[model samples]
Target: MRPILLSGHERALTQVKFSKEGDLIFSVSKDHTVCAWYSANGERFGTYKGHVGALWTVDVDPHTRLLATGGADNTMRLWEVQTGKLLKTWDYLTSIKRVEFSEDGKQLLGVTEKRTGQLSHIVVYDIDSNPEAEQPDEPTLRIIVDELPRVTVAGFSFLSQYIVSGHEDGSVSQWDAKTGELITNVFSHDADMQVTDLQWSADRTYFLTASKDKQAKLHDARSMEVLKTYVADTPLNSAAITPDPQSYVILGGGQAAMDVTTTSARQGKFEARFYHKVFEEEIGRVRGHFGPLNYVAVDPTGKCYCSGGEDGYVRVHHFDPPYFDFKFEVEREAASQSRM
Candidate 1:
């Protein structure tokens, strides 16, 4: 399938997200800029100008009117999506590594990096969707992660009942969303591999985590059980779960840029690999990015998928007819049997 390339960032991209309606894409990069692009033709729509340091993560509200970003500026900022207006900024001691809106967009969550004298923290704030409304200056709840390794990625879970976090030591912890209490913890990935990304399913009932261990694992939100694992040859940086009509997982990673000059580089690891969700077998791949892919985001509408890479470009790809028709032998047989 042909892909639409959006070159909006000057440095390596860290995260990419699609608006709920699937009409717009938001991307953040190490260039310290945030860009908005049209999904249809990859047109540059607008840029949110702030953040002195490199941006690490970005997310849009469900209504598409609000935007949130976290960065090395040691701050998490909110913006008015339509006008590109800066709404509020929350300062922290260290870099803000991740930011996400809750399922209903009623709350926002951010993860801070642990450095020097500062400890990593998972903070939640009640969000007011209206652009003109003054956002709160203080977090509603803050969970100081002193008991575990630094948090690398985190987000809200099903019904906003739980908060899930991935750690630098390759562990996943579940917390009470309202009271900031630790519920349970699981060492889902290999020790010290460092979880790189965490993304939730559409319903938020379960989620996926990608790690530098060269693998991605699926976990039940409520039970904290390891549901499945998808393995790759290269250390993974990102992973995504497609929406309903499609049952697939998208994985992206490769040899880091620092390792490229070592003469041991391979090409296959740079490609985005797709695997069957139920069968746990790789089904296909999309290749183009020359550098390691840092993140992959599937359109909530399931109409397209995109990848942001160390190459400083976001490739948006809409699906082809074969993508919808693909099925395993068992799936085909079961469909034919139903017709009988």
Candidate 2:
């Protein structure tokens, strides 16, 4: 299979997000730039340059043309996607690790690094009414509450009622979206290894989490119980659960550059792994990226999956009939068009 090469940037990419149409790729780089590129031709769509320090993450709203970016500079800025204009900026005074758009796109959720022993807080911003633009005294809903650890909150999801966060403490917590109340914390693993990433299934019934413990865990979102676990060779940095909620593909290896250490050189090539839910085992692993893995997302349909890593490469992978019998029609079209 021929691989489509997206031009590498000067600095390492911190995060990548795809538009709802699956046509464009949004990337946040340590070079302090947020860039949008055509996933097909690798064409540059637009760039936002308001971040003062290394851009840590970028999230796009599904329904509206809005973008949220967080940086090492301890700020989260909201942008108008069409004009690339900065709408508002919130200062947190700590490194902002991840930012996510609520499912309905009405609110923005941000998780910041914890310096002191104080519990980490998830800040919710109301973007609906820009009362600050009209009435300076208008209240902006900023809630500070205890969270799992201030470690990398690599993944987050919000349904119509609740918001869920996956944290470095190897746990996933559900909270009330409207009141910011803690509902429950689901402990999937015994160790404190970072739960690097997570994604909810289409119906919001189940979610998947990847951890530094070299495992990907599936949990029942409703009961908060561990459903299954897939053992990996190295640390699993990020993962994306398929739309079906039955399976998921994980980006294995931490988000660090690969080097030929005596111990690791004897190991093997680093790559991503795919697990089958029904069989409850790892059926396939793709050794495409040479560097440590960063992120993985299965297109809305369950067919094809995309991964980006520290090698500054984004690879879109395709599977044949036995593994994936065209379960995801939308992703199949993308894979067909790109010849992935």
Candidate 3:
């Protein structure tokens, strides 16, 4: 499939996200800007340019009406998605590393980096979903990460029953969304390898995590159990699960750019790898980026998938008919036997 290349960011991309309907793609970069694009043609919709420092994360509300972003500017800001108006800003002690809207969009969460003597924190606020409604200044909940390692990524789980977070020390923590109480913590990934990304399934009953340990794992959100594991040769930066009709997981990462100059692209492993979710086997891989891929996000409708690379481009790829038709030998045999 021919990929639509979006060269909207000047610097390396930090994260990429698709709207609920998969009609739009939102991307944030270390260039201190966020860009919105039409998923169909990769046409630039607009840019949000208020952050003074590098942006690390971006997420849109379910309705695609509000945008939440966090950055090194030491602030988490909200913007009206349609008009690109700055709606609210919540100042913090350090760079905000990740931002996300809950399942309902009535609440928002941001994870602050532990830096300059400041402790990492997971802060949540009551979101006014309506673009015109004034957002509150104070957070409804604040979680300080004093005992464990610093937080690297976090998000709300199914029904907003739990708030899940990945830590810098390769551990994952589950918290009560309403009471801000810690439920359990599990060191699933290799120790000392930071958990780089956390992404949920379509139903949010389970989630996937990528780590610097050269591995990605699927975990049960409620029980905190490691359900499955996908191993890779290089450290992983991001992992995403495809929605219905496709049982595959996307893994994106490679060796650092500085360390890969002497090696070719093939040896560098700068490609997005697709693995069979149920079988835990690699199905295929897509190569394009010269530098390491920082993040990968799948279209909610399972029509296409996109990857943000350190090469400063977002590649949107639509699946071909062959992609939908290909099946494992076991699957083919099952289908044939069931027909009798």
Candidate 4:
């Protein structure tokens, strides 16, 4: 597969996501702005601007008509996707690290870092609430887990009844979204290894996590048991699963914060690795970025995926027909051998 490079951000990209309808791509960057583009051809649509500080994350609602963004300005804001008009803003005491919409689009979740640095909180807002009505002083649910290390990534479950979070100390926790009650906590990696990203499978039966510990793991979403582990030579920053039935995992990462001063330095440490989900075999790597890749997202159809990096570039990679042909052949061979 060849990557179509999309360049515009003046600083590192923090998040990249394809719209639910698969027509547009949206990305947020340390440049303090969010931009939209045509998913098929990489044409720039327009930029969404308002934040006074660097943007950290973004998510689109299930309908793909609204967007949510979190930033160092200590607020999460909602915007209309068509005209880029700011819809609402929820202020916080510190920088917002992540923002996500529930599967139903009726709720929004956000994680923020407090001024004390060690303390973090998760807030869930009722998106279906009347916008014309008086805005509440606080979120519908505020969850403060003092026992957890600082959170790195978080999202709602497929049913939107539970909130799952990954922490700086390599732990994973689940909580009741409505009651703000802790459900379970599991040690996922070695001490001090941060869980950098999390992605759920298309069916929501399993979830994948990437970590600073040089590994990406697949876990059963219900049992919370480790199902498989994919090891890498360098620390992994982001991971995602294709929506295809024969799902393959895509991951990206590198040595932390290497200075890219020369041609060779630019070529090193930024590769998107592919792995077969069932067989756990490495397939291929896509190399292009000059710095560490920070985010990746697979399109809903599973024919392509996109990556954002610390080098301030977004790349969209579409698979060649032969790639899928070869993958299916391997799957068939494995299935036949198992039946014998």
Candidate 5:
């Protein structure tokens, strides 16, 4: 596979996501800017620039016309995708770490962090209402999760019935999206490790969690049972499973920030690694990034995937057709062997 390198961010890239239509890509960075690009050719469209502080996260609505972003400024802002005009802003008492739109684009979810008391909160807002109407004084649902470890990442379920959050202490919690009630919490990893990222499978039957404990695990979404585990030499920062029929798990990570300078640091461990979703076998790896990778996202077509890195660059990789053809053959072979 050949990667198309898109570089413009002056600082580390925080997140990168493809639009629902898979025609556009959005990236946010510590440089305090969010950029839009043509995913097909890696051409720059324009940069949205109103954040006063370094941006931590961004999300595109289901309709792909509105963009929501939050950052160190303790504010969440909505912008029009076509004009890059700031449409609305919500100010909070703390910085926002992550933001996501519900599957139906009716609600917005955000995780806010307060440095003073090291407190965290999950905020949900009604985004589908008339924009011209007066705004409510408070969010639709705001829950203080201060008792649990700091939340690192969160996302809505496929049907938007629940919100799942990964915490710094390697725990996963499910919450009622409508009522802000806690459903259940699972200790996914060792007590000392941190859960860095969580992603639901394309079928929504299972989800994957990447942890600082140097492992990625696949779990049954309903029962929360451990289905499989992929271990690495270094902590995993992010992971994603390709859509059904050709399901493959892609993981990206490397040595922790402080361990990067050590003499024992393993070379090439930062490359993106691929594994068979069913058999849990390492299939291949893609090498390009010089620094640790922060996130990985597969487009809706599953023909290409994107990676954001601490090196301040986003790489879009389009796979050759033969790659998928070979995977299909392998799947058939595995099935035949299992039946015998």
Candidate 6:
């Protein structure tokens, strides 16, 4: 596994996104710089400077070939990927937590902090127009919900035309990506723990939510139902659903197992299980990391994945390799045959 070193001091990496070609990776750091890198060689590409505060999230629109970034500055900026030129600065009255582009790149969807007396809002903006246009129009609609206790918004997924926003309160909502209509709010255990990460399966039929409540859950996107939930030994902050969506890989950092004895500093507990159609069963486990994992992302091919955590290290794991372990076994078998 190759490690890609990144800049940005000791600040938390809020978001990491891959370009359409998957050759370049862009990460927004608490240091307030958007650093791009060549994934293959771990070479630095370029950096974009504009945000005064930490960049909270970033999304790349495939059709327009533009990058949209949201920040703690209560604004969103659009940039040209190749040139790193700032195209536009979008202003909002609230701090933007999550920003996403539509399937066609004609619109932008976001969730923001609730302002005074205002409930949480899901907003939609037309990309072709501007907030400061000659005849500016307000964002299409606002869906106000019970305010989120935490200011952080986990992430959003665009399943078909519906937008799923996972909040810090362990609640997931389905919204009309175009109209901002509230479809359904999915509730599993009513734990009220924060949902730190979320992802929709490749087929968009089911989605996964990882929470600090010590569980990773799967929900039916169409019905907003909790199909299954896996309990972890410790608080789970991050998880990933494989492309197949039949299994899930979850990170508990230093979560202790049922048989764990000593509390070593080693965060050596990671688990991947095959759930869903198999009635939610545990399939595999690994004690892979030496520190609590901060994030886990599966590549497009589903043949490999990456993880980064509090240890300030990133590691890549190959799921499939045709020639792995040939040397040791071959030598052992040759010795045994010779002795025979």
Across residues 1-340, which tens digit of lDDT does each residue of candidate 2 receive?
Answer: 3445555556666677777666667888787888877766667788987888988788888743888899989888887777788877878768788888766666677878777754566777655633224212222344464545654663334364666777667877776677767788877865688788776665667777888888888877666788888787778777676665335455566434544243352254467776765345676677766666677766564545667666667666554566545335555686698995
Q: Write the per-residue lDDT of candidate 5 for residues 1-340, one digit (tens) a residue.
A: 7799999888878888888777788999899999998889899888998999999899988688778999999999888888897878899888998999887777888899746775889988888533444444468998889778888888888777888888888988888877888888899787869888888776566789999898899877666678999887778989888875567899999876566666332473778998888788888888888778888888866878899887799999988886677565666898889999
lDDT agreement with native, every candidate: 0.94, 0.68, 0.95, 0.85, 0.83, 0.61
Lowest-sum lDDT 10-residue window in model 4:
128-137
Error of 3 at 136 (Å): 0.8
Candidate 6 structure quality by residue, lDDT tens digits, 157-234: 543467777776677777776565777766663457777667656555677777778777888777778877877666
lDDT (10s digit) by residue, model 3, range 207-319: 99999999999999999999999999999999999998889999999997678788887788999999999999999999999889999999999999999998899999999
Span of ten consecutive residues with least summed lDDT in model 3: 256-265
lDDT, candidate 1, residue 225?
99
Query: In what order do the candidates fall by lDDT, top score first?
Result: 3, 1, 4, 5, 2, 6
lDDT of 2 at 262: 37
Q: lDDT winner among the candidates? A: 3
Off by over 4 Å in 6: 7-9, 115-118, 128-138, 146-160, 244-264, 267-291, 311-340
Stronger candidate by TM-score (4 vs 6): 4
Kindly report the root-mean-square deviation of model 2 from the true structure over all alpha carbons: 5.9
User: Which pairs of residues collide in model 5?
Assistant: none
Q: Given candidate 1, what's the lDDT at residue 118?
A: 90
Per-residue lDDT value at 150 in model 2: 53
Give lDDT for model 2.
Answer: 0.68
For model 1, state the Cα shift of residue 90 in Å.
Answer: 0.7
TM-score of every candidate relative to the true structure: 0.98, 0.83, 0.98, 0.93, 0.92, 0.76
lDDT of 1 at 53: 98
